[model samples]
Target: MTSFGIWGLIPPVLTITLAFITKDVMVSLFLGIFSGALIVAGGNPLVAIINLTDMVAGSLNDGWNIRIFLFCALLGGLVGMLSKTGSAHAFGRWAADKLHTQKTSLLMTWFCGLLIFIDDYFNSLAVGTVMRPITDKNKVSRAQLAYILDSTAAPVCILVPISSWVITVMSIVKGSEGFDALGVSEFSFFIRSVPYNLYALLTIIMVLVIILSGRNFGPMAKSIAYAQETGNLYNEKYGPAPGEIDIDGDVNADKAKPLDMLFPIIVLIVSAVILFPVTTYLSSIDGETITSVGAAAASMSLGDAFNNTDASMALFYAVIFTLVITYIYYTVRKLFTIKEASGAITDGIKSMVPALIILTMAWTIGTVIKNSPADGGLGLAAYLSDAVVGGGFPIALVPVIAFALSALISFSTGTSWGTFAIMIPIVMPIAVGLAQAKGLADAGLLNAAMISVSAVLGGSVFGDHASPISDTTILSSTGAGCPHLEHVATQMPYAITTAVCALVGFFVGGIFLNVLAAWIVTLACFAAAMVFLPKILNN
Candidate 1:
């Protein structure tokens, strides 16, 4: 790392500010990357441009990065194929007739997101793809649909014990020595933190409040109102246009069966169920083959199995399984000519180009901050940990401050997992030290540590929901066929509302050493914000 120092913060700050002002995600991200390169290149404009290319190349070439990109792209093709076979329209018509109201449509989407708890990526793309048509027909805006897709994604994943998120968090926390002092398992500690993870809990709460109340505000309100009034679900400013998620122009709607959509989705879910364990067993293998489920479970604890699993690779496998099955099913039923299927696949991959570009740029900018000699990257994290310690903030407020720090970094980086990589290591050690020094009881110390971990997780997800360049954000837009910037505009008010409540909840939780009370107040705050803020903002 170079000696760039505090200047590393410039890129993300600049990106957010510019994106808000420009409403142009692509240029905002590129400029953010360029700014980081400029600082890292010692202000030499030419060198910075050259550094930009290298940084982008490095990010795209990364194995994990490429894996996620391919997964999104391949899944995009599946969506396109669904539309091409006229399954989306048939399904939408059928869903519209059944749901009969906008509230049910949105709630159904939210419920689906909650059910797909195995992985966040799966939750996002799958929910968006499946629900877009239904929601659109019921007069729900793409922005609103994207909001539900994103809100329920990482937030739901983090809460579920069997998810990749839980497995990862457990692995990291278990490695910390603090839990030894408390005499609790990492999984147990994480479970206790659930009530205290204000943002995640409140986000889901806010979604329900918005849906059940049948009220919305800000850009989202306008979008929903417009859709209801005009039967035009897309706002032109925030997207490439809304019909891309629709049927091919030449398709015969009558030929499309709802099963054309349901069958593949079912296959994808099954593949994920099968692959999660197989991936775990394989990754956990030292030198021997795992011949049976019983043997695999015996060899590793559930948490350990998940920790060892490669979620990205496993997702890749799921997408491939879905694509192969979907295409073959279509061709076998004579629903698609070989040429039509091939074209749909090509267009589907093409549709993901915007998201892929944003993901690459976001990844590059993250590297600029982390790897740069300046204080903005890894150095920034270290510096902040020291600053937080050195600051005279009370022990009870550590969770609040940690939440803020995690949010900033994740927002800047556009990756919650990356935020976890940086913030968890810092917070874990701090928790152990603080807990030991306070001479706190086991429950008290556990409470403090849980707050800290939960803060990081909640804040990372909130920030990811807010960030324009975020992968889930892009995918949500792609799935809903909304404009990328429009999704950001509509989503920010909701995310920030939950975040403000969560921040207050953390402080209250710390003060009273009670999680349940904090959750009640947090959800209440979200409810008030939803009812009043929209009215105030609309006025």
Candidate 2:
């Protein structure tokens, strides 16, 4: 109910503007955070400076956020070791023999993204680390690679049932009063809603279409053309990208083997998959003590454990375990000496410095914008939520409305999780109420509810794909070793196209309360996009 009026809009708007203009994410994020701090400090410059530092520190204080920070840095170290040991190069060589063409190489990257659906952060960084070398070898532009990474990362996570994103959505839904009143369990609702998640589904479809058809438009087309013609993965004008490191000049390059890289990554993936439920089960045990891992496994259902899993913590532990084993593995193989391995890891951590700084600033600015007014933050989500609810649209349009509003909030704030937290509770009840008021049957009402929830899920992903400040977007660029803004610029067109298709789907579904009708119209829209968009935009 409390807000800073229009003041909430300034920070994100300014940050986004400055990022595009200056192509400096750190400075843009800092000024955005400082401006918000200044507002929070009531226009006092000195207090604003102090508030900025405190806010940045405060954002880092959360256990989950800090774990994610460590996971990224540790993952970078793992990547560095992989490169230094010539693992990435050797694997790329192995892949190049089979992949042969750009299309096959990119398709493999897209498939890899789909396979790693546990967490978006893990998906982006892990897929990028392994696939970047292959993509580069095949003349795929870093922008195209980033786009594939971004599109698949969040979209696939949201679509899969056993992912961190789904668990979070389930938790939110379980806590909502509407789901309780409807006598629906969160798991059931989420599963039912998945089919209606037009945006995420359409976005994934769009990625395949682009990859298969080799159609490029907008900045992505330009970047691809430039890469194919000049043999440079990125624009020279953009210079070095965040998380970019040279893996070609390592001393041990001649001795690297394909398994050297593949083995460590396989360890990371298997470790994360195992740890997610194990940690959650361990955390669930209370009062009585569970003695062994086998005993813990016997105690709870895998579904329940995953429902309550801490994805960040799971990834944090996975990366740590991988780093330890990898260091020993590389050294034992005589690829690098102990000191050499240490130095490579240090450089790898250093490579992630830009991503880390940008991530920290992104969190700080999100805090400034989403924190309540009483907490010295702008309450942007509250303001926008209030505006949408107060607009007084017809009930049948709830799906379309929810989609648009969720996109706006997520894009402006650059945090889809924050958007979900704000929108779900508000939108769910209204949807149920509207369905009831229309004298709809139980099946029809459930259909409406599913469509509405799916819209929110889809629209939030649109922002995650397109927003410059989005953590997934940032990580995608970092992992792909592409300039952040160039990734943003190239990805926006594809994101917008998918969004347009989703909007049509939501509109049709809302009017008819039919999921099948929604899918048909959505596909039709996409078909039109595929046939005509390149012709229109490529010019």
Candidate 3:
């Protein structure tokens, strides 16, 4: 209701408008940031300039933000090197030989998506890049590719125990007095409750079912028909012709050994998994039991052991490692000259310039929201939680309301982390208090589990799956090479369907039924979507 809250809506509106108007997302994003800075400075031109520099500096200094930026940069470099070495094409050819049918291709796409569950950003980019060519060869549309990536992004993250997300949610739950009142450790409660996260579990099943059934609906169905008629799943400009080799014919002719493409990705995945635990251990090397953020902080500080510890410094190291490894592997194999490898890296970075701009602008807008007057921003989330409790709603409905509010904030702000940060402290205590009030003393364990895990997961992913400003959404669009708005428009119906079903499942299945029955009902809904919807829509 405050002017600051109204101001918050301006950045996305301007960014989206400029992106469509100029067909340049980056330009639009920067302008949006500038406008936000102006508003934050209260129209003081001099203060606006100063705040802009400070915002950028603060973002760069933020430990989590720095690591994420570096991760994206390293991923970009790895993708470039793979493309330069023709490894992607090599893998595509190999996959083509092994899988003969559309169903196989689709299933493979889903499996790969499932396996790369470490991070949503990583999953969206890696899966889309690796699978796009194969899907196109099998006549699948870019919209379909976007759908798979979008569905997997949030759903996969929710299920993973050791992900950055799990850590964030755990911290929030543990800090809340409400959770302590429920008489269980937040982490223990969350682990036990994972089985009951019906929405996330069902969404994963729904994705696999969609892949197996080969039935598309909404914009996705139209896209599939278009691809069938035209034989171009993505835009004609982006992909190779049906029978022709890629632009680099000689490179395509040379069959890359499987290790060339698979080895690095496997290394990246295994390294992350192994290093996470090791990093956690090392973080406590300072005599402090390392929490998740603490571990990230420790990892940032262990520059020499890991080869770079400073956030800014580690980024440079990662870049150098990627370039050197790429050069050595491709140059020795004679996949490309030194010049071609260099050019490919340059092109890859150039391709991501727009994304970087968008990220920076998004970061700035986040800054404005963080620093804005309490009355002017979404501080209303806290007030709203109080209002809900005052309205005599059952304690069980706390999680449901939190989930819905989180979804709304995520949708409007276009970031899950921000929404999570704002809601967790406010909602968790209310849940615990309500559970006690309901005289569910024995059921405290179950109630805590539901409130902490179910609510957080639901809230975190609601916007991520559907929000146009969401990083996952953008990455999915970029990966599929689908127009951003097109992907949003096509996928909205599916996201809404799942969300609606999830609401009913959470209320009736999660609250009323036993835990096992809740899961069954959730899975049943997924199955119905897979089997019934396509037939109904196609007819």
Error of 3 at 274 (Å): 6.4
Could you arrange the candidates by TM-score from highest to lowest?
Answer: 2, 1, 3
**Highest-lDDT candidate:** 2
Write model 2 residue lDDT over 1-539, tens digit each, in one string: 48797887788677657755664556766887898899888999999999888988986897766876777677767766766776655665676678868899899888878876755765687678778888887788999999999999999989865554665566555544356556555655776788899999888888998899988888899999999899989986866787654453456566888788668867887887898788877666664677666677788888766655776677688889988988888888889988888887887788777666766665676667656878878877556545544665566689999899889767866666655654665567667767766677578878878898888888888887788888899999999999988898899988998898899999999999999999999999989988888899888
TM-score comparison, 1 vs 3, better candidate? 1
Give me the candidate number with maximum TM-score. 2
Q: Evaluate residue 297 in candidate 2 and report its C-alpha lDDT on the 0 to 100 scale.
A: 74
Residue 498, candidate 1: alpha-carbon lDDT: 83
Across residues 345-448, which tens digit of lDDT does each residue of candidate 3 receive? 67656655544444545455444443435422322223333455566667656556666776676676566654554456556555655555456665764554
Candidate 3 colliding pairs:
303-308, 303-309
Query: Which regions of candidate 3 are displaced past 4 Å?
Result: 1-90, 180-190, 232-257, 260-392, 441-443, 449-453, 530-532
* C-alpha TM-scores of all predictions: 0.65, 0.66, 0.62
